[model samples]
Target chain A: MANIHDVAKAAGVSISTVSYALSGKRSIGEETRRRIADAVRELGYRPNAGARMLASTRTNIFAVTAPLHSGTYEPAHMAFVLAVTRAARAYDYDVLLLTEDEATKGLRRVAASRLVDGVIVLDVSKDDERTKLLRELDIPAVVIGIPDDTEELVCVDLDFRAAAEQSVRRLADLGHRRIGLLGHPEQIYARGSNFPHRFRAGFLDAASALGVDAAFAMPGHGPVGVRAALDELFEKQPDMTGLVLNCEEPIQASVLDILADRGVRVPEDLSVISACSSFDTTRFHPPLDVIPLVAAETCVRAVELVVEQIAGAEGPHVELVPPHYSEHGSTAPVPDLRDAR
Target chain B: MANIHDVAKAAGVSISTVSYALSGKRSIGEETRRRIADAVRELGYRPNAGARMLASTRTNIFAVTAPLHSGTYEPAHMAFVLAVTRAARAYDYDVLLLTEDEATKGLRRVAASRLVDGVIVLDVSKDDERTKLLRELDIPAVVIGIPDDTEELVCVDLDFRAAAEQSVRRLADLGHRRIGLLGHPEQIYARGSNFPHRFRAGFLDAASALGVDAAFAMPGHGPVGVRAALDELFEKQPDMTGLVLNCEEPIQASVLDILADRGVRVPEDLSVISACSSFDTTRFHPPLDVIPLVAAETCVRAVELVVEQIAGAEGPHVELVPPHYSEHGSTAPVPDLRDAR
Candidate 1:
């Protein structure tokens, strides 16, 4: 509730003196700093963010741009946002969230106004309009997702291709010869979502090497989408013994329901694993076998990289967190083919 | 990309004329207004938010105060925020999101500086600090959750008590005499979260009226919390044949796992229903029979009510969205008691 003026008045010094003491930019006598600190404690004064930034010549704020939808902030995205925020806070910085539509004007305004020192973008497409703008502005920026043009930009992302291959290898190790993949809705992949395509390529490469039949289907994000995708997959590959789900939330639930309805036992009649974030798998009904991917951790790392770039670090930088899978109740070896039939 | 000056220059008018044209305060010649519009379109000019707010009497922005946790932007909360934003956008407004901790100084700065026209507080506690501050500041505001001190406040919320009662009655109608209630975590309830307490009270009252044996427990959000709570609930009341879940996402998954692990068949061994928002229920696996509560709808309604209040509408107002349940695949009659025994 206490303002800078209150702290200054309590310290019996000018507001400028209090500001300098807090920022530690201009030298103040030890005694004066101590008096200001004591007054701040007494008044419970938290420095004004805008004024502090102005004084320090650093905003200490990172901006993130994502789509603005009714319920788009799922656990994965939320985790990413929070991770960036907490990590920034750890480094004594704050964050400003922006929408994709606002990126053109918003990024320009925030950067020109010095509201943020840097920016980190999420859900980057192959040819992101924001990326083009960022390049033109010459602002230090990082992309959470891979972009088609990463030559001059800093980025942090999962090795989805390797991750998918690893998931398939694990299933193959369990002696599953027939596999089915449940991908996100076609629209997301069609929009050039790098993850899904990378995942598909990896799965196909692994399946071919293992000499097995692999089927792929794109499911909607809802239960209905899940049911339809599964129905089509099952119809196409009725003998498939393993399932790999890449869709988050809605489809995850629907997949569980479809399996339950058909009385197909997990890891017995069918083994299941997914490339979902840890939060997604851990929170579902039957604990899913999932690769432990944390979007938030990735976001945090990206923010750090962007901050470094903003602070004058040279050259394009890329960081990848290799996918690690955690087994829960969903995966197992191929059942007896005859018995399954 | 274009500044006000560009529009003004293109229109052969002063910057003040451009500002007035945009604000529509004083009547301008029809031809001049058309020329200004043409100039704005040609230059792709957009109003600068900060400068516009400072120059004009109104900010045309609304601030939403909520929990700062990563989970705060989950589907339910995200829906509510978006709904309010969409509704506000209809009236040519923008929203400013603030966490509870930021509300005091944040609200004061925005209100005093006229950065926003009003405030809409969500996830409100019985004794909300933000609400108190807003009242003291005499800022036009609406609360999305009910508070103990309801006087002089406009509130839009579901009747959680009634919803809980209805859920219990539905169970009882299906011959579920022994029921268990899974409320949100103890920490959330302890923070004066009114919904969970209201739910508990309502369940208890309804159960008492129906002369049914009922048990209650608080589960944190996530699979671990769900498992722990379920383990505790079952240990305490093994006879409970109906279950109600209140925790969102992470816990929702756990609920399913615990049931599956315990070999408790849903709708057969236990009928489950929860006071969840529509999005939560719709996306949940084995789609839950949900008390169709929507936080965003409530928020939008509350925002409208607040706007009315700011426009000099009459005294205290309370709006309630009635409890409506969706029959997903999760709920059914309790299995015959004899078979259970």
Candidate 2:
């Protein structure tokens, strides 16, 4: 069945433009829109979700470039790549994983060889070399994470800033005056990782606006790191009643365990929420209330954007997915400490 | 420096053949070895370790085909891919990830595309459709995990069966008379997953050989699953003195937590060991004694094997990485039940 890729290819516009023209998300040139319409008619394309996913095309391959940093493969990064690969498959497209030393050169090879019809770039930092290279390629490219300046690229990511703010606000709404935000490693911030930095900024902004006492810093990962971080948090804010964790999966349990060891009751004495990507937060002990960045959804969007662009979607679009947080088993109204006192 | 990939290309053979010809791991045809030597000498190729990773190739892209199962990505599987990508980067090659509906079709697409000089296939099952497909491809391919029969493949994997046996024997050596083995989900076994099945068989076989009573089955994942599995284990063997877990990461902590909650002291009353791919077993509370499958090592080996094959390595081969286990805080000499009585 004809799908978005075909219409975009036929129209010589980006997938986003075709989508915008179809859904009126953006203003498109009349000539381009007419071409798209003509292409849709000629190709018998259907702009439906299921059809978009199963859009079989001339080339059923995607190049996904998310390299391991210094031979250490981060699980979070893996989540993004995995999601994109799986999503591409939904469209009957195979993903060619690329972990290139130089993004520009790696992408150039893939594009030159026509190894893939589209490309999905993972873990875009501010001023990413990959994004710069994406502009030089004719193949449509989508980023799993947003770079600082996406003027010439199409990108999809969770609005991490909003997610962080929502998580902090959720704690505040639970009537907690003193809250804590545990983040990624210190080096992650020092290196100016866009996502972590955005989350940190959003968290602090929300905390300031709400007039809440907040402690923000990178937590050490694993049990030892969690112990040190937890001890430091309680020492810094003895009355802290909620925590927002932005660390890796390995450290979450240790955070709660340390709190429990210190006689702090979850929800009763302290509420905790995580800004994680996994949806199975409810299965964690005490079932954390969470603001999740659904990796799969973001990945699917990226694949669609890239495929359409390759088929002729518009250039340079940024799509920030909204936050999805739930008040599950972990968050509750703050206890009346004044009454206890 | 001219590296292995160059030699393989020049020799008109798979890189693996060149590696085997050099390392004597497999027998290479005399003519092919001579060709590889002639290519190496002509290209000025150096077989040094540093050069091995940075074997600057003409294509500089490797195709990795490990599709997400039913659009769901498994973390363990991701570990393998991540390792391969990182390892490839160390050698200055790019990976082209592929997930085709039919392994046959996917391998064909990647091989035919010439997008990648070589290929790496992840998680080879007993009768992996991909390996069968791999045999037809002109590209040199390495399978990360061993299949039921490797008569037509070069493969690398953790000797899972040996790892399981080591864990079971470790517990038995600790004087644990009865033990429980928690495993992967039921569908994994039902679908005839090779690795899990091998581990189970090995565990049971070792137990019988040691005259140690053992109970084993798939434990559902996460905290809830951990708790239920724990309850069932205890119920089945009230005097169970040891536990072997092959569950996911989320549930590992829960296992330790449940035992702690039950006033069961790790290593003091009961010993535990896991067949996991993660290397940070020591960071968990009580620092689990484990037989870890170093995904990174396997990945590095896969890349190496593939490169060598392209250089004309000989024969279908299986490289079984031995198990690496240690007596960490989670295991100890089993408490003497008679003495306690």
Candidate 3:
């Protein structure tokens, strides 16, 4: 029930000073900001939307443009969205969701109306139309996925290429020479979704550098897709002993199910690693090793970068959060060839 | 580029008339409203946020409170959000997403600050806190699920109970006396999600009325969960000839895979119906007969109802969208008991 006047009186600061401290519009002293924040927490002061907008000329809201594509894994996409919302809440900003169907037009409307302080772009493709608009709109924006051209754009994402190479090295260190990668559905790559392509390229390049036989297939979905993908991988590399899964959660589970049906034991007959997954892999029957695509880490950083941009931060650039690997006994040393024979 | 003055001039009205007509604050004549609409479209006029707020005392935004619980099915949840957003867009309203972590607090803040014209509640549980807050908030709201008490609250959702009863009747008419339902994870039911409980009750009641045997199991997740649930079902009714799937998509696919492993053919060995599912059942191995929980049907209506409330419609009431069934050859006349014996 407390208002700005109460907060100002409690903080022992002028009303305009209190407003400036809360809005981050004109830089007030750090001491003044701390006192204002303390008074706000104590008094539970909530700014009236209209008064806040009029005083600061900034809406404490962010436009989150997340376009769900045909090949989108909902859990992962939802994870990113949830993370961004939570992160923005930490900065006291509400999120306005702009979905795929309204992507560009929504962005234009929000920007022109001064409805949001900045924009956060999710599910960025290699040649996205929104990225071009973001450039022209002259608004503070932080794209969560990297597009082909990063010119004049702030972007953040997991270093998927490095994650792929790391997966290969871990298997190679375990003495596996032939490796196969089960990627997303064919349309995901065909549609030029930024990360899948980056991961695939990194996998191939890492295999070539290590002189290991590598085969890759896009496991579309479900058991049938998993079966066809495995068949193709075996055809490409008959002696494959190591496998990397870089696809949706359902497909990964299907791959495990199909593998079990064929009596191929994980870490015994073939080493398997679930790479760059958003959902937990530990719940799997054999609990595959994982290089997690942590949505919180990337999204938190993206929110910070955009907030900084709104506060007049430096030129635009891309930041890639490094990938970390966790083992769950899904990988092992390749069986001795002589022993197998 | 067209401002209020330009729009007023084009429509041969005063600026205040233009504001009132656009805001729906004071009812304008139907003819004048039509003229204002025409001018708005032809001139491509968009209201500036601050000026519009000052003139109309209305924010053309809705707060969508969608709290994702542990057992929340992401695809269905995402579908509903997307549908609500698209529906709101038809009324030129934007959606501000409020997630689980910020559910009640976010709702209260938006309502208190007059940030949104109305609230759309998603994933409402039996004892939802948001519903209670909504009753006290004095703002326009439309809940997408039925809570325990609909007193003084507007509610919209698929008729889940009817959908369940229809599923039971469909399988019974196929001459299958023994029917089994594979439901969501136990935690989902334990956490008091409203729809599943309603559906389960209706399924049981319908079976009792029809003098047919009914069995239900909560398939937690994955192949192991499916196997365990099937074991439980068969133990309860050894001659189970029809199955109803009321779980997440992954669990449904796992059910088919496990059933195939045991050499059970759909609509022959047993009939299956996907009940109240949001996703397309046609993509299943043997495409299912579905009583779909259509997101758009309910969401579009919910948006309409909330807009009506914002424009001073009737008192709080519950509206249930009727269920519709579709066949995909997943059900047929039950196999003869004599032949099996």
What TM-score would each prediction reach against the true structure? 0.71, 0.70, 0.89
Writing each residue's lDDT as its tens digit, candidate 1 over B212-304 gives: 888888875555667778878887788788998876665666687678777888777888886754446656556788887775567667877
Backbone clashes per model, in order? 7, 37, 0
For each candidate, what is chain B's TM-score? 0.85, 0.78, 0.89
lDDT of 3 by residue, A1-341 (tens): 57889999998999889877876779988788889999999976777786567556788999999888645778889999999999999998999999977888899899877889999999999999999999888889999989999999999999999999999999889889999999999988888789999999999999999988899998745677789999999999888999999998878888888889899989888999999999899999899999999999999999999999999985799899999999999998897652576
| Candidate 2, residue B320: lDDT | 88
- Enumerate the candidates' DockQ scores in order: 0.13, 0.17, 0.54
lDDT of 1 by residue, A210-278 (tens): 887899998865556678889888899988899998876657767877788889887778888978454
Quick one: best TM-score, which candidate? 3
* lDDT by residue for model 2 (A160-228), tens: 888988888887776889998887767676654668887888888989998899997667655677787
Q: What is the Cα root-mean-square deviation between model 2 and the actual structure?
A: 11.2
* Model 3 lDDT at residue B95: 97
**Order of quality (TM-score):** 3, 1, 2
State the displacement of the C-alpha of residue A132, model 2, in Å, after optimal TM-score superposition. Answer: 5.8
Give candidate 1's iRMS in Å, 1 decimal. 5.3
Model 1 docking category: incorrect
Which one wins by TM-score: 1 or 3? Answer: 3
Candidate achieving higher DockQ, 1 or 3: 3
